[model samples]
Target chain A: MTQFIQQLINGLSIGSVYALIALGYTMVYGIIKLINFAHGDIFMFGAYVGMVAITTFKLNFFAALIVAMAVTALFGVIIERVAYKPLRKSSKTAALITAIGVSFLIQNGTQLIMGANIYAFPQIIANQYFDVYGVRINLLQLVIFFTSIILMFILQFIVKKTKLGRAMRSVAVDKDASVLMGVNVDNTITITFAIGSALAAAAGIMVGLYYIKIYPFMGFAPGLKAFVAAVFGGIGIIPGAMIGGFAIGLIETLVAGYGSTLYKDAVVYGILILILIVKPSGLLGKNVKEKV
Target chain B: MKNLLNKKNLVSLVLLVIIFFVFDYLIKARILTPYYRTVLYWMGIYIILSLGLNIIIGITGQLSLGHAGFMSIGAYSAAVVLASNPTITGLFIGMGVGIVLTMIVSFIVAMPTLRLKGDYLAIATLGVGEIIRIVILNMTITNGASGISNIKMLMSWPLLFGFVVLTIFLTNNFKQSAIGRACIAIKEDEIAAEAMGINTTKYKVMAFMFGAVLASVAGSLFATTYYVVKPETFGVNTSINILIIVVFGGMGSLSGSIISTIFIGFVNMALQPYAEMRLISYALVLIIVMIFRPQGLMGAKEVALNVLPDFKSFFRKKEKSS
Candidate 1:
């Protein structure tokens, strides 16, 4: 039972990180209808950026987090403007292929620059633990959980209350109509990318902090699982992403704990295939019939 | 036989025969070098894989990313068979086993997975690929993670390219048939095809199973060539590499797939010294090409094979048309 609680906390920490990244995937997908395959790579890029901020720039943990977010946010905007924006009018497959290219570029380029070997994520946050009711919880887990909740709250507030959020929602619903309504559709899209990227950065940095090991390839597995989470929750639905992320995290941790970790990836992929078949609309998405 | 002897096809067939003989002679003479010969062999294998993938992704409009799973199925089955028999005849039997197993697996996979669309389909297939790799990783018969490397070594240039030819012939004929047209309609617009009574699911399953079996055939060749079968070799990267070839050449164009495979194969060979840049360049090429020309170099266009004697007239006609 103690082990169960311990695992649950760990799952929550990781789940929020997945949720953060899933938000980026969900938002970009919501607006552009492209999967933005580079998102996981972007998350990895953000982690590396945060690592640099602490190791090279000598920034505090919070400061590094902010720096990573800012840098990655700008990077995301540039990617949107250069890679995805031009292909917007073209086929979604083209856009998807380009997104994959960007993903490879970032993942491989990071390997080139950072080397393929895994490195100790600088202990910006010391590994300290606290126990409650015979269950141990770590400081980083608390940070990840609270920080994710706060960030999500802020995101919710922005989308619900802010004008940019309104523009984002409008763009998502009907881009042409939004344009007719005098919304700066391009600007909204860019900002949406920026916001999503920034959130990804936060997730990336927190992940680095929690795992204490950062590598170029670290993003691929979680990226995929988080994508499953997004799809599981109902793609393009923000809160659905959150729920899906937690569910995937819990399932993954439970499987690793009870079952052979060798089949961890297989189980996730199975769920992806199963959920996609059984509930294509996901736990939260509305079923939109295929149009003629 | 008469249809096979049509002017355009006769010219292409004669050209194929000449090229095969020339390469065969070069292999015998050791002129092309073993390294280049191996390159050509791999290229042929890649050609088969990409042609199959093109049938699924380009022609049939299903975004399948689990082809490597099928390829792995072929490769491991063949390797296991060869390990036991260790004869040319056994190798053939292994290939047969591969195709049968691939057919069964793909049929089961396609039945339910084909119902999804677009990105959902892509993710599901990717998941399926990962699952297959993981399953192989844990299986005892596959030697777990160490893989099955003790194959008897009975591979030949004729056998390899023969499969490539078969793949091309099948894909080409399939595309020329009513089934291929139905796939194209689905690619163009699935709902419209369904409205027209095209039995979208059945056609998709047919295309998927066919494409997967071709990959399985290529897989047998791949295992025989490498003399080793590891789960990692048939990972998502391999699947994506095949897709890259299909897209770079031109989706829905067999000739384009061939051209792109050769081009990318040679480029990879040239860039072997700079191993780091090979994938980086591929990524750049995909991004740049997608931005500039999403239809690819051929853009659903084929290289028209005029009779060899008409080379002069071909140029003259081009000049006149211009």
Candidate 2:
């Protein structure tokens, strides 16, 4: 029973990170129908940026978090402007290749800048154990999970309430129509990239704290997993991404606990395949019908 | 007859023969090191993988993130056979058997799954790829993560070079023929191709088979060259890397794929000094190209003589304009 409670906590914490990344993925896919393959690498970049903030700027955990998000958001905008914008009129195949190229560039470029060794996040958040009815929990786990939830809510509020949010929604639904409706489509896209990247940065910081290790290619697994979560939740749906992330988290944690740890990834991917086979549009995604 | 000699086709044919002799002489005279020979082995294998990838991505206009699964099937099959038999004849027999088995497996997997469109196909293929890797990981015959090693080395430069030439020649010929035109028509629009009396399914299956065959050849070469097989080595990353080479070269452009493969391979081998940065360089190439030249280095266009005439046109611009 205690083990179950412990597993739940672990699952929620990791799920929060996956949710944050998935949100970025879902949001970007919603706005621009391109599967931004480089989004994961952007998350990796955020981790590296956060590390730089801690070691170079000597900032506290919160400050580094802000800085990491800001830096990653800026990089996201730059990537959008450079990689995606120019190829707007090209075929999806072209865009797809470009996305791959961007993914490779960011990953390998980071590897060049930072050595292969995993960089440890500063222990500024402080590690403390809190007991809960005979079950002990780490303070950082709660911090990560709650912080992710809070950020998610804030994003929800922005997308659901704010004018810019409405504009973003409009742009995602129909770019041509949004353009006719006086929405700054390009700027909205840039903002989408910014917000998505910022979330990725936050996830990276939290992951760094939990694992105490950061590497150039670290984002590959988590990134791919987050993508699965996004797809599982029905890509382009925000709430779907959150639900999918948490579900993946719970499933992955349970698998690790019950099954061989090596099979965790296989199990997660297998679940995604099964889900996709059953519901092509995902759990929350609506099946869009074409006019033609 | 005189006009035929002046045709670009005849010129290319002659040039190909010359290049082949030069390559053959270099390997025969031992001018090229064994290291170069080994690199060529991977180069040939990569070409096979990339070409197979191109069939799905280029001709069928479907996205797959799991072509490496096909390679894994071939590699493991070949490795298992060679490991069981010590004779040289077994090696040839194993490769032939491996190639055939891989194609059959690919046919089964691709038949039902290729029905899924676009991103769905991508996801399914990815799943299929991961499944293959996991299966390999668990299989006792493959020896799990320790993999299969100390297999007989049955191939060298001369044979590998011949294989590469044959593959290129066959693929190029296919691309120029009516069947290749059918592939292009399919890429342009599947519905339209079907209306034009083309059997979209048949052509798609053919393209898939072609890709699978190349992957099988690559697998055989890898089994012979590396003499080891690991599940992790043939994962989604391998698929993505091959995709990168094909995309970087240009979709539907055989020459482009060959050139890009060599360039990327050269950079990977030569940039060992940079270690981790080599990966960074590759990533940068992917990102930059996607951003700037998403159509790849050639944009579905061949290199070689195809581009030379364009340069010639530039010089003869005034005459043609007049």
Candidate 3:
């Protein structure tokens, strides 16, 4: 029972990060209908930025987190303006290909700058363990799990309450109608990228803190898994990402704990294929009838 | 008869034959070492793999990140057969079996996973590729992580060149067939093609099978060429490299795929001096080309046959045209 409880906490913590990354994937997909393949690299950038802040600025965890998010969000906006904006008027295929190109650019560029060695993150929040109901929990783990919940609620409030959020939502649903209603569609899209990138930065820091390792290629695996989670939860739905993240976390932990650790990736992917095949839109995704 | 005897295409064909002869003799004359010959062999293998992928990406309008999985199936199967049998004839039998088995596996795998679109297909295929990798990584007879080594070596310059010519011929013939037209139709618009009585699913499966089998065939050659087989060699990264070739060459263009394959193959081989930077450079090239030339070098255009010919023949053709 205690092992199960421990696994649950671990799952939730990692799942929170997946959820954060999934939000970035889902938001851009919802608005542009492009997968924005480079979004993972943005998450990677956030990790590097946070690592720099921690190493150079010698700041605490919270300060470094804020700085990383700001930098990533800024970079995301720049990417949107430079790479994506021009390709917007082109075919979706063009945009998709461009996104993949941007992803490769960032990943390869990072490899050039940082070299291939995995950088060790400074242990700002030390691995201090706490017991709950006879199950051990670490401080960083708790922080990840709770912070994500709080952030998710805050996001829900913003999307539901704020005017900018409503405008963004309107644009996602109907771009032409939103344009008619005086929403600066391009600006909204830029803001969406900024927000999503910021969220990804937060996830990046959490992962670095938990794992104590940061690499340029680290984003590929988690980002892919998060995308799967987004699809699993029902893409284009916010709550779905959160739910899917936690589900992925739990399943991953259980599989790794009970089964071979090497096969964990295979099992997770297998589950995703099963879910997609059986339930295409995901658990929360609505099936929008394609127009003939 | 005149259309069929177009002086331009005839000249192009002759030039190709001449180029092949030059290279063939160069290797045969010991001017090009066996190692360099091996590199050329990989170039041919990659061309086959990329062309097959192009049929799916450029023609059928599908994205797959798991092609390496099929290649692994071919490699392992061929390696096992060659190891157990130790006969040169077994190598050919192994390749045939590897290709057929890969086709069957891909067909089964595509049925369940084809529902996902866009990036989702990318993810699923990525997973499938990794799964195959891990499965191979854990298998006993495959030698797990150390990999299966000391397999029978059947690959040589002649065999490789023969296989390359055969693959190119088959792909070209298919490209000229009705099925190729159907694939193009599917790519242009799936729903519209379906409305026109084209079975999109069936065509997709057909195109995917063709690509997978070709990948497997390449895998067979790869196993024989390397004289060993390892799971790590054929993984997600290999799949990505193949994808980069097709995308860089211009999707749906056969000649483009061929040109890009050789270009990338030679560049990648030449860049071997800078081992770590090889992938990074390729990645940079992909980003730059995608932004500047999304349609790729030749776009969807084919190589113009008129560009090739002997000087006298060219003049004769021009005179004849006038």
Candidate 4:
């Protein structure tokens, strides 16, 4: 029972990070209908940026976090403007391939710069453990959980209350109609990318701190799993992404705890296939019929 | 029979024979470097894989990212079979087994996932591909991650050349067949094709299976050439590389696939000097290509022999002269 609680805490901590990344994926997909395969790499970029800021520039943890988010947000905007905007009228397949191209570019480019080696992330925060009901919980995990929750709530408030959020929602619903109503569709899209990337940046820093390790290609697995999470809860729905992230994190932790670690990835992919087969719309996604 | 002996067919056959003899002579004379030979061999394998993938992605408009999974299945199946019976007959038997197994696997993957359109299907196929890799990694027969090594190397320059020709001929024929036309109809518009009584599901599955068959054959050749079959060899990167060849050549154009496969093969060789920057450059090229010319080099058109002028245009010229 104690082990279960401990595992649960670990899952929630990791799940919160997945949620941050999934929000980016869900938002980009919601607006552009492109998977933005490089979103994971953006998370990796954030980690690297945070690492550099702390180690090279001697910035504090929160400052580095803000710096990473800002830098990644800018990168997100640049990628969209340069790689995606031109192919807007092309086939979706072309866009997908381009997104994949961007992903490989970031991953390999980073690898070239970083020499494909894992770097130990410095401990920015003091590691302190707290015990509750005979179950140990770490201060870092608490910080991650609360920070993610606060960020998510702030995102929710923005989406629900802000004008830019309204524009974003309108653009997602109907791009042409929104443009007709003077929504500045392009700016809204750029903003969406920026916001999503910033959130992913936060996740990256948190993950780096939690794991105490960062690498160029570290984003691939977690990014893919976060994508699974987004699909699981309901892709394109903000709250759905949150739910899916935590669910997948928990499922993954429990499976690894009980089953062979070798098959954990297989199990996660199996669940993805099963969910896609059973509920194509996902858990929170509404069933949208093909119109044509 | 008469059509088989047509001038174009004879000329193409003679061209292929001459090319093969030249290549064999060059290798025998040691004029061509071993590096070039290896590159050509890899190019041949990629040509088969990409052509097969084109049938699914370009002609049928079904995007699959799991092609390497099918290829790995073929590679491992062939490797295991050839381990005991190391003969030409064993090679054929291995390829046969690969084809059948790939057909079955592709059919199974296609059935449920084909219902989902576009990106969903892509993700599902990707999932299935990863699942196959993981399963292979864990299986005892697959040697569990260390992979099957030191298989008899049966692939030769002549054999690889022959298979490449056969793959091209078969894929070209399949493209012009009635079933191929149905597949194209579905690609143009699935609903319209369905309305016209075309069995969309059946044709999609058939195209996918045919592609799997070709990939499997290529996989058999790959295992024999390298004398090793590892799970890591068939990953998302392999699948993407094949897709890159297909797209770079021009979707729906067999000739384009051939051209682009050779072109990229040479480009890869050239980029070997800058090993670390190769993939970065490759990704940049993909992005640039998509942005500048999404239709690719051939733009969905086939390269054919321009044997005769149009009779209508000739008559119009005559009328003007008169």
Candidate 5:
């Protein structure tokens, strides 16, 4: 049905955003083995920065996007250096708690500065739609889909072909071994954060453009859902994150479109529990037996 | 009886009685301001919650981020009881209901989660917690998000202070028990513990259930005393806030939890003027503590009176032959 196609479009648009965020989560988790809970906040930060770019400096939409991505990448590097780097040698609990702390700080700190009201994201790209055989599609949705796909391909290329990518992979496999091989584990981790954050920043800008709104608390739900996606596709796996992101997005969109909206969140969280229970290693993750 | 009548036990008991009366006098004589009483109330409540949480996180090394979900369940059930019968007897009934319900729900939750390790378990707990919150948000008894209100207050000073002592005693006793030691072994290494003939999952569930029991009692008190119960009261933010306190204080140290609670409670009270910064400050504290002192302020050291030098030892140092 046309209705199904229409819902699919909507789903892919949002799914692209989830995929972008999930990629970031997967990359950081792959490199550092930390969840990087603050990644969502970095996405939010990107949106805010983009807002400032347009409103204060009167930059064009593309320029603003670039600025957001660049600034957010730098921001991610800083967070890793300050909040997470010290605890790298410490317990996972400490790292996790610190990640949560950084998340809360960014959220509440933004609230204090921005106030609680929802702000309209700058609308530079005029909203337009096309109708074909009763299946109408928003131009922005297509834009989001293609742009994210291109970005994802670019990320894949970087990971597969670049020297830094090789270093990142080696570091992920064995930090001590990689260090002995002269990988510079710390810089590799920092670069991974930067790339992941930049991708999430792109997702942020697109989400704001798609929704036409941005709020300080907007990041939490998507952050969680993206985390689920990363886990679903098998965390620390790039391609898996992509597939998982689209699946969750489609599922969520379909649920909201057909079922009661209130249950949407419950359904998402339910999937999280189910996936974790069924496959703690995730869909694409290989089971590694624990050794004493 | 003989063990109960030991000198240390008697001294602690007498001290508790004396401290209770001192606070009782302050409340009865109206010497303590309402502001101070309110602060003490929250501090006591947080202490109770932290103690329960510590058993799972600190002592057992289980990461349970959904503790607030457990609190919400007990809180709402107890609130319903008090709404109908506003009496001391009702309070006990409410607490009993809370304990029973919390035990069942936590057991079911722990079944799947406890099998996993660290982050997976944390997310699963968070998922379950969020699911519980969302479920209550839609239920008829919960009255949705607006939640239940207009309950008669039953939180007397005696009951509040007594419950605090009871929770501490319970956690301390649990920590010293054989099962508690097994839980610790599991935390230290799950594989090794299982190899040592310990049923890892069973002991984990026991520790989790015991924690829920305490949280539920605290929740019952929260519903009765706070005179309100809403879904928002037990959200992820609230869980993180309580967790920050537990981690800030030493995880395995009861004295650290109590001391850290008092310290953070004072900091929050002082920040009443800047309400916006209050949450931000809590976030900063967690970050700072985790980064600078991941072992927590108290670590595993239980700072108690046993460490205190005797009065005679301070004055009679000359009796020692060199």
Candidate 6:
């Protein structure tokens, strides 16, 4: 029972990180209808940026987090403007291919610059453990959980209460109508990318701290799994992404705990297939028939 | 009958024969280094794989990211068969096994997932590919990451060249066939095709299975050439590489696929000196190509022999018939 609780706690921490990344996927997909395959690589970049801030710039943990998020947010906007905006009028397949190209570019570009070596992240947060009901919980896990929740709350408030959020929602629903309403569709879309990328940056730093190691290609697997989470919870749905992220993280952790670690990836992919088969719209996604 | 007996057909036939003989002589004379020969063999394999992928992604209009899974199945099945009996008959039997297995697997994968459209299908196929890789990584028969090594090297230059030719011939004929036309119709408009009484599901599955079969054949050849089959070799990277070839060549153009496969294959070999920048350059090429000319070089056109037009008009002064 204690072990179960321990695993659950670990799952929550990891799952929250996934939620942060999944939000980026869901939001960008909601607006642009492009998967933004480079989103994961953006998360990777965020970690590297945070690492550089702390190790090179000698910034403290909180300062580095803000720096990383700002840098990544700008990078995300650049990617959308340069790579995706021009292809918007092209075929969906073209946009998808370009997104994949961008993903490869970031991954390989980082590999070229960083030399594909794993870097040990500095311990910015002190690691301290506490026992509750004979179940051990760590301070870092608590920090991750609370920080993600706060960020999610802030995101929810922005979308629900802010004018920019209203514009984002309007654009997501009908780009043409939103344009008619003078929503500045392009600016809204760019802002969406920026917010999503900043959230992913936070996730990246949290993951780096939790795992204590960062690498160039580290984003691929986690990014893919987070995508699965976004789909699982219902793509383009904010709360759905949160739910899906946690569910996937828990499922992955439990599988690794009980089953063979080698099959963890297989199990996650299997669940993705199963979800796709059973609920193509995702768990939280509403079914909309295609119009002729 | 007239078309068959046309001067164009005869000339093309003679040209093909001469080219084959020249290649044979070069191989016999050892004028080509072993490294270059290996590159040629790999190019042939990639040509088959990319052409097959083209039938699915370009013609059939289904996005599949799990092609590497089918290729792995072929590689492993062929390697296991050849390991048991390293004979000419064994090679064919291995290829046969690979084709059958890929057919079954692709059927199962396509049936459930083909119902989804676009990005959903892409993600599902990606998941399927990852699942196949992870399963292979865990399975004992695959030797669990160490991979099947020391397998028989059964593919000769002539054999590979023949298969490449056969693959091109078959895909080209298929493209011009009724079924192929149906696939194109589906790609153009699935609903309109369905309204016209074309069985969209059946043709999509057919195109996918055909692509899978060809991929397996390529995989078998790859295993035999390298004398090893590793799960790692058939990953998302391999699938993407094949996709790049198809897109760069020009979707729905068999000639384009062949040309791009050879071109990219040689370029990859040439870039081996700067291994770190190879993938970066590959990504850049894809981006630049999509941005500049998404239609690709061929732009849905086929390269064929054309008769020379009469040049008498050039010399003659333009005089009205009246």
Candidate 3: what lDDT?
A: 0.82
lDDT of 3 by residue, A83-145 (tens): 888777766666676776677778877888998899998888877998777898899898888
For model 5, the stretches where C-alpha displacement exceeds 4 angstroms are B309-322
Residue B198 lDDT (model 5): 99
Please state every model's RMSD to the true fold in angstroms. Answer: 3.7, 5.2, 3.9, 4.6, 4.1, 5.3
A20-44, model 6: which lDDT tens digit per residue?
Answer: 9999999999998988888999999
Q: How many residue pairs clash in all the candidates, one count each?
A: 0, 13, 0, 0, 0, 0
TM-score of chain B of each: 0.93, 0.86, 0.89, 0.93, 0.93, 0.92
| lDDT scores of the candidates, listed in order | 0.86, 0.81, 0.82, 0.88, 0.86, 0.87
Which predicted model would earn the best lDDT? 4
Q: If you assessed candidate 2 against the hidden native complex, which CAPRI class would it receive?
A: acceptable
Q: Pick by DockQ: which candidate is best?
A: 5
- Model 3 C-alpha lDDT per residue in residues B1-322, reported as the tens digit of each score: 4464566646745765676789889988999998788778889889889988887787677888888999988888889889888676887888888888888888888877765565677667778888888889988978899888988878776777677766766776566578988988987888899999998788888888898899998898889888888888987668878988988888877777888999987887788888658877777667666677777767776553334424323212222232
Candidate 3 local Cα displacement, residue B287, angstroms: 3.2
Give a tens-digit lDDT track for model 6, residues B1-322.
3355344445545655676788888888999878888998889899999989999988888878888888998888888898899877887888999999889989999898887887788788888888888888888888979899998988777898778877876887778778999999998889999999999889999999999999999988898999888888988878888888888998787777888988998898989899879999889888888887886767565554112223211111121122
What lDDT score goes with residue A106 in model 6?
Answer: 94
DockQ winner between candidates 3 and 5? 5
Distance from true location, Cα of B210 in model 5, Å: 1.7
What digit string (tens of lDDT, one per residue) describes model 2 on residues B276-319? 66666666677677667766779877665476873322111112
**Candidate 5, A162: how far from true, in Å?**
1.2
